[model samples]
Target: MTQTVSIADLMSLSGVTFGTSGARGLVSAMTDRICFAYTCGFLQHLENIGQFAPGSHVAIAGDLRPSSSRIMAACAAAIHHKGGHVDFCGFVPSPAVAAYGFARGIASLMVTGSHIPDDRNGIKFNRNDGEVLKSDELGIRAQNITLPDLFDDEDMLGEPTPLGPLIDVATAYVARYVDAFGTEALRGLRLGIYEHSAVGRDILVRLVEQLGGEAYRLGRSETFIPVDTEAVRPEDQALARQWTSELNLDAILSTDGDSDRPLLADESGTWIRGDILGILCARALGIKAVATPVSCNSAAELSGLFDTVSRTRIGSPFVIEAMNNLINAGQVTVCGYEANGGFLLGAEVRLENTRLSALPTRDAVLPILAALVDARRQDVSLSMLQRQLPARYTFSERLQNYPTAQSRALIAHLEAGSEAEILARLTATFGGIAGEVDGIDLTDGLRIHFAGGDIIHLRPSGNAPELRCYTESDTSERSVANNAKALEVVRDLVIG
Candidate 1:
């Protein structure tokens, strides 16, 4: 008799754990059996919740990572074995598959690690309504799922079996924009797309052309590139400047591997922080209420633009939950965004004769297109539009491979003392730049406000093994300088 394996068993044996957005683990640790078990477990949980039925369809997609296809095939097989049909969305953006699934009122799964290194991969699950929240993850973990040992061998699933997408998700996603904003919405803009293996690369270029913009395609890589929007690499910054100067583009747009987190650069090739981009996009759409994570720049409040601003932990599901709460409270025109520049529309919106349906998941194209169209309509440069907001600037960086326990310990040490005591300790460790502690917030992490009007937030990354630091200041230069100094101080503290 073949023995059955439970989801918890697989998770324990393979060390695959749920992160900020999904179940992520190293590719080597995520064997075909593990992926299959997880997928089956997710489906079982959905069925229990009345979200899945026999012969129901599940949309699936993946990124450009080398292992994505193999893992995706395993997921497909699991769905097939569970009596569900598959709508293979192919290599599309995470939002593309999600939007398609939600429209058809079916569950979906995406195989990608987002901005993480190619060695790691993840599976993001979505319900027919929206993204699976923390509660859903808990339920999925509690599910009693079983799979046979036939999926244990790695060699059995070494090669990818290409699956055709049932629907043209790319076209539908593009139409969601062009129809709302019109084909000539960006007519005078010259945009450059840094297409470095993002699944949405070609789609983004085509969208720009369809919107009557002059599209200059740049940086098409056959290999996967882990482009973290929150922690923009120094080399990518230089490349943006080079591309902008050489092409004389009005703006440059790109996204992380899965195309959920956006990267937007001004005409000068200076990349704008994701939080600031979120603020601009919200204001562009005339959003009255907003939900964002605590790590975001406080300019959303400082600008006095939105009627309500709710801050949650550093994750989309948290933000989405908060947004839903606002909606339930009778506040319409609700939206949410992450510091990674992914925007979510919490309600249906109509612009002129076009109506855009709600997509309450992280989306790169919406924010990128909205910001560009807003700038064009205002007849101002993207930089000028940014300047119109409150002068608060923020910078973020991560200490790679830092242990989460160590990060928590350091924060706990400071948080245990009084304000003056904590200030003394911070000044001693971080040098005089720490100044005096004006206030401290432990909402999602340790966020410190200094008398000198600078803010430093330290938190362990929820998705990867790293310690992330965010700094805000009255000026852009100071924010950048303080960010670098804070990371250096933390590195020295950990090493020394």
Candidate 2:
């Protein structure tokens, strides 16, 4: 007799591990059975919501990981089993999938590990309108469907027909960059690109060269480089330092494995934080209304220039929702990018008579191209532009193994108390409260703002099992010190 797998058992598979932006895990762990069931379930939910139109094409894409193709094949098979047509756009960036979905007016999914090791892979799903929400995950999980085992002959029955080459996607995306900032602006710019297992390496090189810039390819690694632009550790920094010294280029540009997150280094080989890059890109784009995460430093720099500045929870979905609201209300001309430097332009909404609006998703390519254009226009170095921005120190740290329930409880406790009361209580226990915010914005976590422009926000990471602490101040020293102190206080409260 064939054994049946419980829904809970499928969900608990080791392949459902944390990724920089979404779920990822080992290919073997993410069994073909689980992949088919989850994807079919997700599609069923979409159909119930009237999201899946009959004969409406769904764009499918994958990264360069060894297992990515297998996952994509499984996902496509699942879609086919559900009577949905799949348009396979093989080996592309996550943003390209999003763009293809929007442009073609169809739902899509990109199979990728996205900067994780080659041993792992996963999928990012997008509705025709935008990304799948947190609520959608629950609905998808509630879906229960059985499929044949990987070793069974039935596993090969639902093979999907591959869509022809995505030349149009590549052509249109590249053309958008060329049109936005003519080739003249990129003249004489030199970039050292670390093509270390990034899917966008070749496309990025072509992009720079097409716009009259030079690109030097370096370090093509066979193994995946799990580089997070936001959380570059000391060892990654060391690698970057060595590469920059060896190349002696104007800058070094790269992205996470699937090219969803961008990383940039200055001429002197200093890796600029994503938040700083966001500010520079916003200024370059001449956007007056900027929306970014509360964790970013751009608000302080573009305060005077922007008409409306809004802060959201740290995710592209939040930023996109805020941007949509502003667009609908006619409150802003352009939406600002987050610290990760994924610029989503409102103008990109129209292409080939179709209203292709800015996708409410994170993309690494847009901001980098925008910054390059800005640098050429101003005849200044990328680092120089960054230095000219208003100085606001932003520091982020995460405490791993901190239970989400405990973190939520602490946030609730802090929120229930008044600022004065909370400060008083903190002082009575651990010394004095250095600052506070306008009533701990409990929308996502415990965010306290002080009168001196100091801020600390604590929340559990959505993509990881860690509790994250974000602090901002007028100076880097104060930001670091305050973050350390706040983390210590929180730790003592939880552990003691």
Candidate 3:
């Protein structure tokens, strides 16, 4: 028996929704059938767009989460059902599988939850050329798929078949760096790799060793540890410092769950902000034009590093869209980055007979490598190299479990209110921390600019039920203080 299912309806029923990247939800809600149906819709939509065909190959990969393999199996089953070939690129970084798929002009899926906890998971979809943009997501949501009777009544598939033959992408992924920067890119540097169950742990080690750096592996965990680059846990912060000082390392590197977002700490073991890392990486590559989320540190513009700075909504799809515009506007060198330190190169960088091809997706490896190379070239420590940038600093934190509806209602309440009413509400909450609102931006969320140059921006988390708060100030101390103060006020506004 076959049943017609609307993807949009399934999204509501399953509680899995598309976020800044892909469809994410609690693992318990992502039954085998749910994942299968979602994949079918994804494939069918791609087929309609001519990015997929009956006999086309679909690359699949995943992170180290305990539930990821099961999700990948369900996704593979959908590919087989759709009369497509499955190229299982098992247990790799999100970018690795996408790169393989792009090289072959095939679509791909990555089973991951990124920086979220292991109890949650997600599927990141990619078209042949690159990530599935917002329009592609809309097409997928509009799919009315006919799901075959392949599961039990509870929407669970029994005993998934094995995903055959693993495809190795390690060599090519590492080669992408070595070919451009040479095998001795990090020669004479002792780098520490904090491998906390990220799927790309071993691959990162291989990359370091291949680049002629002495790689020190630390904190290799079997249990799933969700290391969010945006919010480095306090324990992880202490651990970085301990390892760097105890081992006398030049720098330390790590990535989030699927390894798209990078975490880099300086010699003193203080983690570098992602946007700060982006500035250094762009400088290393001599990027001319750049696109970044508005939540990123304003120093990206204040530093005067790039010729053009395009600030978009806080998502890679938006950044990619802006990056495309930069390219179309005839900017010779182009790139983009997120507040999470995931760097995206929009154009191939050719410098002095060395060419590095562009992979316009969030990539952890490029920033790690670029920062290392830049620091080495300048004969300065990563911390010293950072000091050269402008002083603007940014910080972000979130109140988890805040209902999405309430978050939207809070923002909408203020936006719909008159100027004085909005100011009264804002000042009632944040008046002590910052003065009256000087400006407001409703681009993606509620961004309030204070008369004192402080900023407080609030938006609902894309994937999870969380209310995110971002703050910016001229000094790091003020930035951190503002973030803490803002979150406290936001909590009261949304919950109180």
Give residue 147's lDDT in candidate 3 (0 to 100).
89
Candidate 2 TM-score to native:
0.84
lDDT of 2 by residue, 302-331 (tens): 447677777887777677777777777785
| Tens-digit per-residue lDDT, 88-121, candidate 1 | 8889999999999999999999999999999999
Best by TM-score: 3
Off by over 4 Å in 3: 494-496
Deviation from truth (RMSD, Å), model 1 = 1.8
Candidate number achieving the greatest lDDT relative to the actual structure:
3
lDDT per residue, candidate 3, 1-496, as tens digits? 9999999999999899899989999999999989999999999999998888889999999999999989999999999999999998999999999999989999999999999999999999999998988999999999998988889977888879578899998779889988888887899999999999988999889999989899999999999998989888999999999999999999998999899999999999999999999999999899989999988888888888888999999899899899999999999899999999999999999855589988999999999999998888789999999899987788888888888998888888777768878877777668789887767888879888889999999999897888888888888888889889888776766433
Q: What lDDT is obtained when candidate 2 is compared to the true structure?
A: 0.70
Per-model TM against the reference: 0.96, 0.84, 0.98
Worst 10 residues of 1 by lDDT: 151-160
The weakest ten consecutive residues by lDDT in model 3 span: 487-496
* Candidate order, lDDT descending: 3, 1, 2
